[model samples]
Target: MHIAFVSLETVHHRDTETNRRLRTICELLRDAGHDVHVFCAPHWGGDHPQFEQDGITYHAIAESTDARSGVAFRLPIALARAKPDVIHVTATPPGQVAPAAVGAMLARTPLVLEWYGDGGVFPHRWRRWAAGRADRLHVPSELVATWIREQGLSGDSIETVPNPIDLERIRSVDPGEEVDVVYARRLDEGANLESLFLGLAELRRKDWTATVIGDGPEREAYEQLASDLRIRDRITFRGECSREERIAVYRGAHVFAQTAEHCVFPTEMCWALASGCVGIVEYHVDSSAHELVEGLDRGFRTTSEAELADAIVEAGDLERLDYDETFAEYDRSEILDRYLVQYRTLQDEQGLL
Candidate 1:
């Protein structure tokens, strides 16, 4: 299958969660023997498509929305060039869907959409209508699937494809005697990271260390909060890293604690599990956490900091949540197989399988 994945904001845009997932999924599809191409508006503040990286092909094109009208301006040409068997879209912004809708129509390709987050954030009808028209919809967690249906759509349109991990990248890390808690996500508006710092402040008194492995807008605020909490020495804000660095951090950490309550898929937590850490999740709701806990059953969900703190305390005793079981589903071969299946299914639906 020739698959074209379209997204204006890609992981390269900022190395955020959704982009990371998009990269992993596209890689998996390519590894499975399907021809896959990625399309994004290069975040380098330029226009036109960027070509293949390593073996993966990318087309970074002209894009402007309320901020950039170039989104529609870029797609039709890219679609004509790609001539994909299936066009998959990620994160459908209200005004942006028309570009996707137009591009897919012009290319005469059926569309598959992987909605990255809940519509509650968007709160608009244009997105809803566009979502309904897609050939198939993917949600990374059941919680997200539920929310999609709650918005008056058919559950038949969606399938759950959890965020994938680079099993090989994680397998290289040798777990030693390191005892640190790891939190790896962007520190942006949606991430309520300040609370995690305060919660860790309470834990530092117990001879535990915390590892933060990402950068975001609140870097200054979070660093200041750490200093104010007097846990600065104990907290290491290892800024954006190559995939290798992240696996190293996860291997050395004993627990993975994420307090963000709004993610459709708290990808770092899944990576930590793949890295063999005991997962401690503080999701706003249990949807994503339940999916995280499916393997080793290591995830703990709480709505309050006190509860999150209590979870941390419990996590201290969890000697080993053998990640192999949690990560088994994401084994390189298995992930590739799943995509092969999705590709074939889509092709069969188009009489091209």
Candidate 2:
């Protein structure tokens, strides 16, 4: 089947969860023998002529193109020409959904919306309307589906799929090297980084060295807080390392500690667990991250700093398990099959079969 992805944002232009998922989906579909085409606007710091990468082909709409606006002008024409069975779009840019809905309407094809199950920030009004425009919708979690259904979308119209784990070349390295805790996430708004920071301070007071491996809007604030907490000397801030570096750090460390205040992060942390690090989650009542690691791996969910710190230390000696067996369900090939099921479902509903 011909499947075209309409994304207003460029991939390399931004380092974000959305970009990573979209790129992974497109490439996986391409590998599965589907004809995948992409339409994107200019990247944040990049303004280059249109080009394709890997197996996916891309077209830059225009110099001043907005992803939302790109749909009205470029998308319908492309969809009419390429004639895909379905057009899957990310639930962002707030503007892309409307135009793409209309394009699919004109082509009489299905439009499916994709997003992380974070109680999507998109308006219920828009999501409901977007659902009406498309034959179906896709979300990464049941938690998100509940939120969208509350906004008037029918639960039957939505399918839940797990987010893709961006796999890197992981080598099986010895896991008993050091007793360290590693935190890797953007220190930005909405990211509850302080939980990890203060937790780090609590550990370092006991003479442990915590590694912080990312930077963002709250970088300086976190840095200052580390100094104020008197744990600055015990932390190593390796600002923005490449994917390889992150995997290497995971292999060398004994534990991977992730506690993002009020955000769901188990999907990313699962990669760390799969790579053989004992995972540690700072427990919170509403944290869906806890649910991801409960039964399959070596992650600990704790309610207090003492319990958390103790868990970190305990992770070092625990026998490392092969999470590859657990997470293999989310591998590129598996995700593609789930997607193909969605496409076939849409086709069946529209009587295209």
Candidate 3:
């Protein structure tokens, strides 16, 4: 199968969740012996109109990275000429979806839109138009799928395909030194580390230590909050550790707390849960973190600091595990199979099978 991925900005231009997810899907397609090509503004060196890297080919639709309108103008022709079996486009610049749809129609190919719902602010009309244009929409979580439905798209057109986790790596890596509780994420204003800090502060009399596993502008503020709570010495700040490092910490920790103010999907919390840490997520109006713990016995969802602290303490009663098989459904192979299934379904609907 030939798959064409349309995104004005590639991961080479800037690293973003939407770009990374598109790249991952394209690379996975390439690895599975499918012909994959990425159409985007030039992110490669030299004057080449096309560049092949890793297993996939990237076609430069515009010379400048900032030339979104130029890219949009050229994409329809480029995509039609590429003549892929299916066209997968990112909704980063929602304006480009209409052009990509034109190309797909011209090429008589299925058009699938990847909308993570985390892409920076765009007009609601643009999102609604993009949702309406694509034959199918791929979202990372049910939360995002709901958002798409709110855009007036039918639930039938939206599919929830989650982010893939490397289960093999989680199995192979050894656990790092243990901590009673762990919280990991960029410590930005939206981090909401205060929820966990207050929860921990409530347990000052208890004999438990915690670890914070990320860094950002708000790290100092978070640390100072811990100090002011008088539990600074009990909390270790290991900012921005590698994947393995994080997995090890998760393996060692008994509970993983997620309190972010906003999240399309609680990816870090998912990782921690897969590593055997009992998940404790705080509910936020804008966050979908609690979705991971809804029906699971190994996790808890809390609505306040008191509930979070109680959940953390209750999590101690569960057996400590180094790894859990429940999340194996989210492994790379499983996710890749899901994508292939979606692609085949789209092809069948188009009578191209």
Q: How should the candidates be ordered by TM-score, best one leading?
A: 3, 2, 1
Q: After superposition, how far is residue 350 of candidate 3 from its true place, in Å?
A: 1.1
* Model 3 steric clash pairs: none
What lDDT does each candidate get? Answer: 0.72, 0.70, 0.86
Could you give the C-alpha RMSD of every candidate to the true structure, in order shown?
A: 3.9, 3.6, 1.5
lDDT of 3 by residue, 72-191 (tens): 678888888988999998887776777788889889999998988787433546556766878888888888877767756788888898888888999999998888999998888899
Native-vs-model 1 lDDT? 0.72
True-structure RMSD for candidate 2: 3.6
- Model 1 Cα lDDT, one tens digit per residue, 1-353: 78888877666765655677778888877776777787766554345446666567777654532415576677767786678888888754455565676777788777777776744534656567668787788778888888788878888868787767767767676554475688887787766777778777777768877878788898888889899999988888888987777777777777888777677776777777787788776656633765676545566766677777778888877776424555778566776676557766867876754
Off by over 4 Å in 1: 8-16, 38-53, 56-83, 95-109, 118-126, 201-205, 227-230, 294-296, 321-323
Work out how many backbone clashes candidate 1 has. 11
* Cα error, candidate 3, residue 221 (Å): 1.0
Off by over 4 Å in 2: 12-15, 42-50, 60-63, 67-70, 117-120, 124-127, 166-168, 172-177, 203-207, 227-230, 262-267, 283-287, 313-317, 321-324
Candidate 1 least-lDDT 10 residues: 60-69
lDDT of 2 by residue, 33-104 (tens): 877877677553466645667767776664544554445676667666667788887776656776677678
Q: Estimate each model's TM-score.
A: 0.80, 0.82, 0.96
Give candidate 3's whole-model lDDT: 0.86
